[model samples]
Target chain A: MIEILKQGWHTTIQDLGRLGSQSFGVPISGAMDLNAFQWANKLLNNNSSAACLEMTSKGPELKFHEPSFIAFTGAIMQAFLNSKPVKMYKPIEVKKGDVLKFSSVTLGCRTYMAILGGFQSEKVLGCRSQYKGVTLEDRIVKENLLLFNRNAFTQKGARVKTKTTDYKDVNLKVYQGPEYHLLNSHSQNEFKTKQFTISPSNNRMGYRLNEKILQQLPEIWTAPTLPGTVQLTPDGTLIILMRDAQVTGGYSRILQLSDNALNLLAQKSTKDVIKFELITL
Target chain B: MNNKLPFTFFRMHPKVILLEWEQDPSTETLKELTHFKANILKYSMGVSQITLGYCSLLVQWKEDIINYSDAKKNLIALYSNLSINSTPAKTKHWTLPVCYEGEFALDLAHLSSELKLSKDTIIELHSKTIYTVYFIGFLPGFLYLDGLDSKLFFPRKKNPRLVIPKGAVAIGGKQTGIYPNESPGGWHIIGNTPISLFNTKNETPCFAKSGDTLSFYAVDEAEYQKIQCVNNPKAYLTKVK
Candidate 1:
């Protein structure tokens, strides 16, 4: 068991996410950065679907109750165990009552921490990822206890240097969505030329990009949408649906990000400039 | 039935394939979608999911696609050749209860005055028609039901409510639906249902499927209370033969 001394912002227990339920209108509320989440699990030799704690901006301060292996990934945050400095991307051992603390950093927007056996959070609709309506609580609150297999951590794994994701890169590769042709010719060209900044109105659901794509085209009949779908609203706001995005939408789906691009975009904070590099399927 | 399987396919993502129809939302489009979905699920090699929509289907494959054209070609061929529709044409019809009295009818009076219809008449029109569940979105179990009477068709609120209570049944443009859970909604609330539309404990969270048909029946405040306390609201759900 891990006891949370201080809760992190938008902290939630997430795995790869809930799939096969989108047919019933459930959002795939998974980790924002899949590469990092999967890497953290890989470092601990845990199952890929093992639940990990995902936090945005600030991370949590927790007290470990048993000897276990853990890993931190995504953001290059300054983390400490018993006030001793710990490095990211490396699996570290923690004894009973060892306090782990994380300091806020501006380098990345989201972070993932994986335990030895994975978090045993409540699973709903075949996922451990927390969301409103589906789960009893949406976030990991302060003083809450997280369940995990005590003392099940194996031998310390070799430190892995990150390679899958480039956090600093803002150029996200995208594909033309189902309704991409709906955009006027001039507006369609704007994606290649214009650099969109992440707006303040961003969350787990979506990232509302700065600047209007166009005076929105007519609404399409409600269609199935996915994470990384860039929707154009009536007012012309270009919002990129994230992992927590709804399954269906009525807005014009103008562009779609590849799974890798979506993971890259997750690291960006508000006001970060990004360019859409259109790629042929 | 859509002859020759009228659909335009697209490689939307590395793992996602989109099959879209040109027509507007209709029972015919739904029938075709339902038929194709059932077949795709049966023949899934790595197809993870096939999500339903008004006029399209988003098919997601578990593995990344090495050849988009080949996958699209195969799906097109599969739909065109499968003529024997194993899926039953007749859909399950349900009659759900709603209470339009007091606070449950948040926008009833305003909608009545705006549409130039009495409150009772408005309720009559809403409850009379059987609505098609085009898809569920916005919130979990929030059905995107079509078939609102032209008379009750009103635009969504200019300013959406901060919090719309769960079970709030409302109309927004040509659509009418019940909110399965509490959410911030812009639709005009005409009534509320005490019976839960979604429960996580059940194997199937929402009883209403995409192809299913449903209608609302007005219930009194007393009856709403009696039905609200029960653990399983499915017991109260009436099946229309």
Candidate 2:
């Protein structure tokens, strides 16, 4: 058992999201950065689908009740185990009664912490991801007792690390969306050349992009939308749907981001300038 | 643009493909889309998730490493191999109860004054029509219902309310929906439903499906409280046909 000594900003348990529930209008609530989420599990040799604690902006302080193993990845947050500093993307061992604390983050906006056998939580719709009405609680609060399986298997000593990203000058890769044909010829050419900034109105659902493009496209019939679908509103604002995005929408889907691009964009925050590089299929 | 194919398939992502119909959206088109969506899920294997909307169907695979070309071809093959006139699952007509008195009917006065209709007329017209459940979106259990009475048509709020209370049945333009969860919305709240539209504890979180039909019946505040107090509010559902 792990005790949550401190509550952080937007801390929630997420897996690959509540799958197979789109027909019911449930948002697929999952990790923002899938790359980091998978790596944390790989480091500890845990199941790839293991649930992890996703922390945004700030991180929580956790106290372990038993000997456990953990791996931290994403956003490069400052962390410590009993006053000694620890690095990200490494499997760290904790003795009983050890308190782990995490501070502010840089180079990104979100972080992931994966335990050895994964965090055990009530599964709603076959996923451990948390959502407002779908789950009992939207976030993990202070004084919340977290349950994790105590594994007996020992990890084979293996070295693994990925270069930390600065998230600067990175291009958000994309493909033309279903409604790409609706864009005028001039608008299509100009969209690629223009650089956009991430607006402050960004969250788990979507990132609203700044700077309007000159497209007066009418709303399409409500259609199915996914995490990486880039929708252009009538006023030309670009709204890129994220992990917790609704199942359907009524806007022009102009572009679809690659999985890798979605992961990279998750690290970005408001005011960050980004350019979309279209990878034609 | 492709006249030969009845529907066009676009690769939304490496592991996701969107099959969209060429026909304009209508009740008939929705029926066709429903048939196609069901068959794709039934015929295909290894499909993780499949969802349908106004005129399109999204098919997602379980495995990450998918050859998009093969997957798209398989989807296309599945579409052409079968006849489109397969029997669809029967749709349900749900007669849900709603209270229009006091706090529940926040916008009824404004609607009556704006549309020049009486408050009683507004409530009567809204409940009279059997609205079609076009699809569910925007929020969980928030049904995208159609067939709102034109007499009660009103534009959405210019500045949307930051928090529209859950179960607040409202109308916006030609569409009407219940705010299954408290959310920021522009729809005018005309009434509140006692029946819980969504409950995660239930095996099927939402009782209604895309092809289902819904209608609201006026209930007194006393009855609303009675139903709400019941541990299983959905048990009161009158599924007509």
Candidate 3:
């Protein structure tokens, strides 16, 4: 068992999200950075879809009640074990009563923490991802107790090394969306040239770009939307839907990020600048 | 019926394909979409999720598990052979109770004045109509209901409320829906329901699904309280043919 001493900013337990539930209007609330999420689990030889704590900007102070093997991945948040600094992208053994904490994020926006086996929580709609309205609790709070399987810690594990990337000013590759041709030639050129900053309104649902497209696009009847779908609002704002985005939308879908680009964009913080590059399938 | 249905098929994501029909929202279109969705679920492989919209359907699969080209070919072949003469699936009907007094009906007076109808008449008109659940979107379990009374049609509020309470029955741009959960919305709230429309603990989280029918009946404060006091408000729901 692990107890949260201090709940960090926007910490939630997530897996690969609830599949087959979009038809019911449930958002796929999974890890923002899939690469990091997978790495964290891989380091501990845990299941790829193991539930992990996804921390945004800040991270929680946790005290382990039992000895466990853990790993931290994604944005390089300064993590420490019992006041001694720990490294990212590798497995570390923790004794009982050891406290784990993280300092302010240095590079990226989100971080993931994975334990041997995984955290156990109530499965709502065949998934443990904490989505508001779908789950009893939307996020981790102070004093929250997370339970893990004891059998997972009994087996010996080796430390695994992984590569980390700098997310600063990354170029996101995107495919033309269904309504990509709606933009005039000049607007299309501007879209490819403009460097848009991530707005403060960014969340698990979507990141609203700071710059506008300055294109006139008529609204169609509501259409299907998915994670990584870039939609142009009537007011010209370009919003990139993320993991927890709604299943359907009414805005014009102008671009869709590649899977790798989606993971890279998830690590970007507010005010981080990114350029979109068109890619062919 | 025309044998050839016009549609544009494209990949939204590497694992997600979209089939968009060149048609508007109507009973026939919905019926066709329903049939298509049923066929895909029955015949497709590795399909993780399927989402339907007014005129489009998005099918998502597990990456690398199924051949995309083969899946697309199968979908096209299945669609071509589909018979439109078959009857669409039967829709279930639910009669929900709504209380339209005090805080529950914040925009009632304004709506009554704007539409040039008495508040009682507005309520009567709303209660009399049978609404079809077009699709669930905007929020979880939020039923995008169609068949709103043309007389009660009103534009959305210029300024949206930061927090519209759950179970708030609202109208926005010719559609009426009940908020399954609290969310920011621009719709005018005319009433509030005592029953929970989306309960995650239930086998099927959402009470009403797409193609389901719903009707609202006005209830006074006392009856509203009585329903709320029930052990399971969902138990009070009557499913009719």
Candidate 4:
């Protein structure tokens, strides 16, 4: 068992999200960044679907109750083990009594902390993901004992570099949705041409982009917005629905990002400029 | 563009066809569109899922089995056959139990004051009316029902609370919904339900599906416990029609 020594901002346990039900209004609450989560688990040689800790914007501090192997990926928060600085995106060894701490983050909004064996929680609806609203527990604070299988994975001990794919400069691919042509050709051209910055209010629910796509096309009706769905609000703002986003939205969906493009948005930090790319005809 | 006239569409997605009835759609139009989607799912193209909302039905399919061209042809054929008088083959009806008192309904008092009605009257008004499950979205098993009495309608909270417990029955604008699993929400919560809106262990996780009819029944604390604790499927005496 590993113990939480410090609780960071909005850290929670997440897996591939609760799927199998969308008609009932459940948003898939899984790892926001699939690539980062898979990579973190891969370092520990754990299953890709294993539940891991998700630290948002900032990270928390944990103390090992016993010897354990762990890895940190995604957001590059200055990490330290036992007061000595540790590298991001690589597995590190910690003995009993060693404390792991994270300072301010410089890039991205979320980080993944994966142990050799995934963390354990009381499963709800077959999912152990901590949806703060549903589970009633907000934060995993000090003295919280998180359990995992002791002998889950064989110790490789060899460190692997976290794959840092450059998506910041890449053009995000988008498919035309039902409301695509609702925006006249002028607005559609503007949407494809212009770059937009992620608004500061962005979180798991959705990312509100600071753009003027809405100024061109205004009329819309209530429609089901899927994950990766780009909704254009009346005020020219873009709300990109995330993992924990509402199952349905009322905004006109001008563009629906391909599943691949959604991976890029998960790593995007506030103020990072991103451009959209149309899928090849 | 004519304000009242519905815009026609030959195509929406690569395969999917758009059939619009009105800009601000009426319940009659939504029901008709849902029937059209249901008809398409029955014979040709096994559309994996069909999502019905206020004004549209999103039909998702397995692109591997059916290409865009075939899907477009089948969709237009189905749309032309649809008529305004068509009714769904089957409609699911549900009567959920609600404990609308004390901490269970934290926002009840505020809602009563805003709507200028007593808490009991609010409960009476809420339970007396039958609601249509217009759509299911926002969360799993979270049914968005229409037909709330206009007197009870209110705007969502400006600043949403961090957490609202599961089974919280809330109202926002003209729509009423029960939060299956708690997340940040701005709905006016007037009651609590003992029935689990979503249970992943079951074949169908969401208790109420689209095109289902929902009614609320008032209950006390003891009754709430009996219903909440009963995990056995057989113990749920309420028949889902």
Candidate 5:
């Protein structure tokens, strides 16, 4: 068991998310950064879809009850164990009662923490994701205890390094949506040329970017939308749907992030400047 | 004006295509499209998933069996010679029981004031109307229902509640819906339904599906408890066809 000593802004347990339930009004809730999540799991040699911890801006301080191997990925945050500096990307073995803490990050938005054996929790809709203040009633907080398999984690100590040398820039690839032609040429040019900042109004549902992409579109009927769909609401704001987005929407979709780009957007921090690259193929 | 509709196919990506629709997915058209998609799925083994919405069908494909050109040609042929004959369809109509008193309805008085209708009139009008399930979205088991009386059109709350209880019957803008689970919502709560709109344990999580007809019934507080307290609660009775 591991105990939460300090709760950060928001932290939740997430897996590969629920599938085949979109038509039934279910959002696929999984790790925001698939690369980091999978990498963390690979370090532990666990299943790809094993549940991991997802943390935002501020991260939690935890105390391990049993010695275990853990890996932290995504965001270049300052991490420590028992007041000593530790690595970020590689797996680390902690003795029982060792305290792990994370400070604010200088880059990226969200970070992921993975245990060797995965977290144990009641699976809802075949997933263990905790949607704060949304689906389930409780959220992980200070003094909370989490149970896991001890034997499974100790089989092989991880050889991953703490420093992640391969951090990719947030350059998203997008394709024209159904209403792309509705935008005027000048507005479309501006959308491709200008850089947009990640806004604070971001969650698992959608990320509202600080950009003027929506100002270009002519009036049209509401259309069906999906995750990764970049919608331009009437106010010229860009709202990119995330994991828990609605199955359909009313706003005009000016651009849609590709399957690979959606994973990158999940790790973006507030105020990070990003440019969109049009997908040619 | 001639009613003839031409089928157009647009490339969404290498894996998907958008089937343009001249008309919205109505009850009849939805059935036809559903059958058409089923037909394609049966004959074309390469299709991965087909997502049907109000106005379009996003057909995703597997690259192993069919290429993009061949799949598009097959779809065009299927649409051009679409059989217009009616086929046997499954229809379900349900009567859901609702409670309109006390904490069960947080925004009843506010909704009454905004629409200029008394609380009783609001409840009566809301419960009496027959609604159709358009598409389920937003949250698990959440229904985007159509057929709310236009006179009762009201905007969503300026600031949505962080947690709205499950089974809350609410309205927003021109649409009406039920919060199947505890979720944050901006809809104006008119009443509470004892019925479970969604249950993962149930064989079919969502009690209602696209093309299902629903009618709401007003029940007093005592009846609400009686309906809610029982194990395997029966809040809505359905007529299966």
Candidate 6:
């Protein structure tokens, strides 16, 4: 068992997410960066869908009740074990009563921490990803106790390194959306030329862009939406739906990020400048 | 039924295929969509999730296991042979009780004045018709109900409210629905229901699904509170058809 001493900005237990539930209006709430999430599990030799703690901006201070093997990945969150600095992208052994604390985030917007086996959380609708309506609690709070297998075998801890990219500025590749043709020629050109910054009002639901393209189009019927879908509002705001976005929407879907782009964009913070690049399959 | 399938298929993602029908929302098109969805689910292989919308369906599969070209070909062939006249699967019916008094019905009086109808007349018109559950979206258990009385049609608010209370029966444009949870919305609230539309503990979280029928009946505050205390699902849900 691990007890949270101080909760971070937005900490939640997430797995690969709840699949086969979008038809019922459930959002696929999971780790923002799939690449990093996979790496955390891979380092610990855990299952790909093992539930891990996802921390945003910063991470919680946790005290382990029993000895355990843990790994940290995604967005260097200046983590330390018992006041000693720990390296990212590698598994570390923690003894009982050891406290792990994460300070200011030096890079990336989210981080993932994986245990040897996985965290044991109540599964709602075939997944353990924490969403408000589906899960008992939306996010981790102070004094929350997370239970895990205490007797799970840990592999020999190895110091491994992986190449990390700087997500400060990125070019997100996207495919044309269903309503891409609705935009006039000039507006389409502007969409590709203008660099949009991530607005401060970003969340797991979506990332609202700072720039707006005032192009008018006929209202469309509410249609199916997914993560990485870029919707254009009437006010011209370009919102990129993220992992926890709704299954359907009414706005014009103008662009959809590629899977690689979605993973890269998840590491970006507010005010990060990004340009949309159109790609053909 | 239309003999020609009026759908345009495209790849939304590497592993996601979207089939969008050109027809507008109508009973005929909805039924056709329902048939198509059922057939696709029955025939398709390696499908991970299938989501239905107002006029489209998104089929997602595992990219590593299913080739996009092969899946697209199979789906197109399946669509061509789909029979719309076949009987659909059984649909559930739910009769919900709503209270339209005091704080629950924030816009009932305003809507009554704007539509030039008495509050009682508005309530009577809304409760008389049976609504079809189009698709659940936007929020969990948030049913996009169809069959609103044309007389009750009202435009959505220009400025959306920051927080609309849960179970607030609302109207916007030509549609009526009940908010399953408290969130920001632009719909005009006319009533509130005490029964929870969504419960995570249940095997299926949503009470009603697509193609289900729902009818709202007017209830006083006393009755609403009485029904709220009943936790049994079998007690509240009754099949009319």
Better structure of 1 and 6 per TM-score:
1
Model 6: what is its DockQ? 0.80
Q: Provide per-model DockQ scores.
A: 0.85, 0.76, 0.81, 0.42, 0.49, 0.80
The better-scoring model by TM-score among 4 and 5 is 5
Q: Note the B-chain TM-score for every model.
A: 0.94, 0.89, 0.91, 0.84, 0.86, 0.91
Residue A75's lDDT within candidate 2 is 90
Better of 1 and 5 by DockQ: 1
- Flag regions of model 6 displaced more than 4 Å: A158-163, B1-3, B64-67, B84-86, B231-241
| lDDT winner between candidates 4 and 5 | 5
- Model 3: DockQ score: 0.81
Error of 5 at A156 (Å): 4.0
Whole-model Cα lDDT of every candidate shown, in order: 0.86, 0.85, 0.86, 0.74, 0.75, 0.86
Residue pairs in clash, model 6: none
Report RMSD (Å) for each prediction in the order shown.
1.6, 2.6, 2.0, 5.6, 3.8, 1.9
Model 5 agreement with the true structure over A222-256: per-residue lDDT tens digits: 34566788888777888999877776677887788
Off by over 4 Å in 2: A156-166, B1-5, B64-77, B80-86, B231-241
lDDT of 3 at A142: 76
**Model 6 chain B lDDT-worst window of ten:** B231-240
For every model in order, the fraction of real contacts preserved is: 0.87, 0.81, 0.82, 0.64, 0.51, 0.77
| TM-score: the better of candidates 2 and 6 | 6
The true-versus-predicted C-alpha distance at residue B191 of model 4, in Å, is 4.9
Candidate 3 regions with alpha-carbon error over 4 angstroms: A154-157, B1-3, B64-69, B84-87, B231-241
Clashing pairs in 5: A87-A162, A88-A162, A90-A160, A90-A161
User: Per-residue lDDT for A174-270 in model 1, tens only?
Assistant: 9999889978889988998999999999899999988887655998888889999999998999999999999999899999998889999989978
Docking class for candidate 6 = high
lDDT of 3 by residue, B1-241 (tens): 4436788887777788888988778767776787778777877777877899998998888774346678778888878766743445666788889999888999999999999999999999999998888789888888888899999989999999999999899989888989988999999999999888778877887877777778889999888889877726456446755
